[model samples]
Target: MPEYQRIHVSYNGRLGVPVGLFVAVDHLRRAGRLSPDDEALWLTVDDWFIANLPEPPQYSDGNTAGVVTWFKPPLPAAMQRRVEVATGLLSKYGVPWSISESDDPGEIVYEDDFQVAVVPPVRGEPSPMPAGVTLGPTTGGSKQSLGTDASAAARRHLAYYATELADRANRPASPDRQRQLAAFIAQCEALELATILEVGCGGGRDGVALQEAGFDYRGVDLTPEAIDICSEHGLAVTVASAADLPFEDDSFDALWTMSTLMHLDGDGFSRAVAEVGRVVRPGGLVAVGLWGSEPPRRRVDEHGRLFVRRSDSQVRQALSRIGSVETFETGQWYDDGEHYQYFTLRAT
Candidate 1:
């Protein structure tokens, strides 16, 4: 018989040592010294064992032959030497072992050459689409259907045109204007909300207005440059579309999307409205402001970027499927060569 060296193993805090024992076991099994069906495999490093070949059956009085329960102190040096010899012989035979603790080396829990598998956490299933909703085929495709101008120059040109459209539509608030708007939003919500979500927050002007009024606000915009401007001014904003917001459902108590849906037309607008409704909890207030016009109206603003112009009735019909609508059309008249309709619809 070949002489084998002995080693001691110990561990603390984690299961790293047990994994190591599994590795050592793999080597011993390969050398034919350790049988695949060995009963010792059932005993863990936390369990004590005698080194004799018959596995020294676990019971002390030798009456019973099951595995031992507790470990006792004052193990004989010869028994310890036998354990060291077993571990060392396994090691010399290129076997792998796993231990639970690092300080004492003889401890062995599991040993195997095969792969160890880990189970990942389970994720919840996606929510079902709402009633009366129709999703187009291209909605889930990996291609960009919109904003395809072919060339980089064309894309830049179109982007510039969009920016100009956004700018021409820009109506900055006077010093007292934002305060009144904030008050209006708070009144509509029926209470002071600590956190607010603003989708399609153009330029983040309204978001800033709300933040200044003491609400912790996060705004998201589709236009990257618009989001950049909002961030430049020290606002928490991100470039994200409203229809596919990067947030969990029902994450906010209040949502404010001001005059922002005019850009979305037809089914796109309807879907976005429904998505917003899904994200807001029951009885949560959503204040929507939009430019109103009769249906079948589409116009390119001064910058030549197209926008949908919907009447009050069309807007109501589109969103009513998701929540109750309370329309607020400001009677303030403006004739800047463009029809300006303001509404504040409350989502039930």
Candidate 2:
């Protein structure tokens, strides 16, 4: 396994820091100087910094503080050489950068008008910060909320989807999803279940099918526009979060969510699943669908929203924590060669 290295990329002050940083990182990846994992780390760190970029200290005129840090993964010797050769590339685009090395994790080894500080990771230690870089204070001593960021991203995604709702509604449901829905309905029928809650029911595509199949369905989503669209079709819908469903305990006999929980990170996913368990009666059915990959990872979409792709075992393990996973499967659900995992769970 290749060791990871932290590369803190900072600028004095700039308007398009995130976009510029992304361009540089993508250039390195395209030139084969950075691996896919390296690119992912770079983007993740960039997103973090962009999301948390501090306000200028005390009446500063600058629009941004203009400092960002990233943790770069270990590069092979060849890649390192390529990177060295490409050192002056960003400067061509008017983004000057200085490179510095550090053995201690989180120590600022160097600083100049342009600095790229490198720090090694210390196992089991809280993440380190370079010298003189302080994250803003937390409110009420509570940890900084990723939830806020997630909600903002969710809003942006939903807003984008809102503009395409008609096109999405006309698209046929994936055959795998159709089969999974059929199987879940069969199980619900066997248990004489009636009420169903569909979380993240964007345009009510599947929700309409569930209602047509004689289930009492209620759909919830974070996007009001989506809810409005669904409601126009005579579907019961509301705006809500999967992590904090407004329904009471044992309020539903079954829960269905797809391509939704993946928007959440591991902790958020777990909390949402726990909430699912809470609102669902014991032995109620749950069907979860998400894109899957080995070792579960996060990636930013074109809209800058973070999505986690879970492995089959990872999905099963997560569901097992809340209930028994009665069925687990995966298939190519899109023409784009992307595979999706579906799990049928029985709430404990």
Candidate 3:
């Protein structure tokens, strides 16, 4: 059976936010204009959540992880009361609001007795960052209350990277990743490719390699924090989703995206691959990687995560929509027991 879930839902049809963040938006909006009474009520509810629940990392990190959380259904009497109180305040303010009471909310990040966090698929391109709304490197101590400046789409896009934690710094590339990099370079060597675009370039770790190889390396990622990190290392990485690369069609010689597409499951995944095909020149090479299974597993599990492992044939089948899969390989990421899948495809 699908798991029952409860969340302070957004109206965008795919995204949901916790009630705490929702209320924080209204409370902060009012507090800026000197509404002390609303501030007091906000404190009343905020204190309860802070004391009773473990705050999700996305909230603490200014939601740079691009994830929002949901509470499982069948709330305890104490918790249900808080939900009621939160709704009452929204009603009092005449603010639009909703509750998601259903199974299969989105791709869940983690779930426990109290709540489940999810990265819901975004509807269209993420909204441009509002002026004066800057994201920076942050510690784990503060909760950034959402303000009216950000749109629901912007919030969902932010939630997309919620699972990519802070530790994805410019660390040394693993041996398996290094080997995969060499393989990609070798595949492009005979063709003498010049420019490469990395979709979802995390921490510029691999972009640094491609740059050092004398290729003009450019990248795009959804997380602004990640863009900041990657740029510090002199990589020209921007903030954009894979489904919506900012470049024109047939712009680059090749593309590289590793372990990134899986986060965008179902239609989101397919659309991104098509977009990937759109940017790279026809007949150019594209390298794709993911943590996957050997026998070709592809399905949303009971927990709502897009768990996957595609056999080489299945991988070829997936790429057939846009190109021909030339070579495919899988190796266990020895540090963890999980398997890593790689593919080199020729854009059509």
Index of the highest-TM-score prediction: 2
- Those runs of model 2 whose alpha carbons end farther than 4 Å from true positions after fitting are 1-152, 333-338
Candidate 1: tens digits of C-alpha lDDT, residues 106-182: 32332222111221122223234335543332121112232123222223323553355356336676544455476
**Model 2, 34-71: lDDT tens per residue?**
32223333333334334443322321433133333433
Model 3: lDDT equals 0.65
Off by over 4 Å in 3: 1-166, 294-312, 333-338
For lDDT, candidate 2 versus 3, the one ahead is 3
| Candidate 3 C-alpha lDDT tens digits along 1-348 | 346555442333212333334443343343352133333333434455666777776666566656666777677655655565566456545545665555776788777678877776644333343355444332333233432232333343344343443466645778888888998887777799999999978778888889988899999875555665676788887656687677899999999999888666566677788899899999999999987655545664433334555555555677888898887777774443457778888999
Q: Residue 95's C-alpha lDDT in candidate 1?
A: 46
Tell me the whole-model lDDT of each prediction, alpha carbons only.
0.49, 0.62, 0.65
Per-residue lDDT, model 2, residue 9, is 38
Worst 10 residues of 3 by lDDT: 9-18
Q: Which candidate number maximizes lDDT?
A: 3
TM-score of 1: 0.49
* Clashing residue pairs for model 3: 65-161, 65-162, 66-158, 66-159, 66-160, 66-162, 67-159, 293-309
lDDT score for candidate 2 against the true structure: 0.62
Candidate 1, residue 155: CA error in Å?
4.6
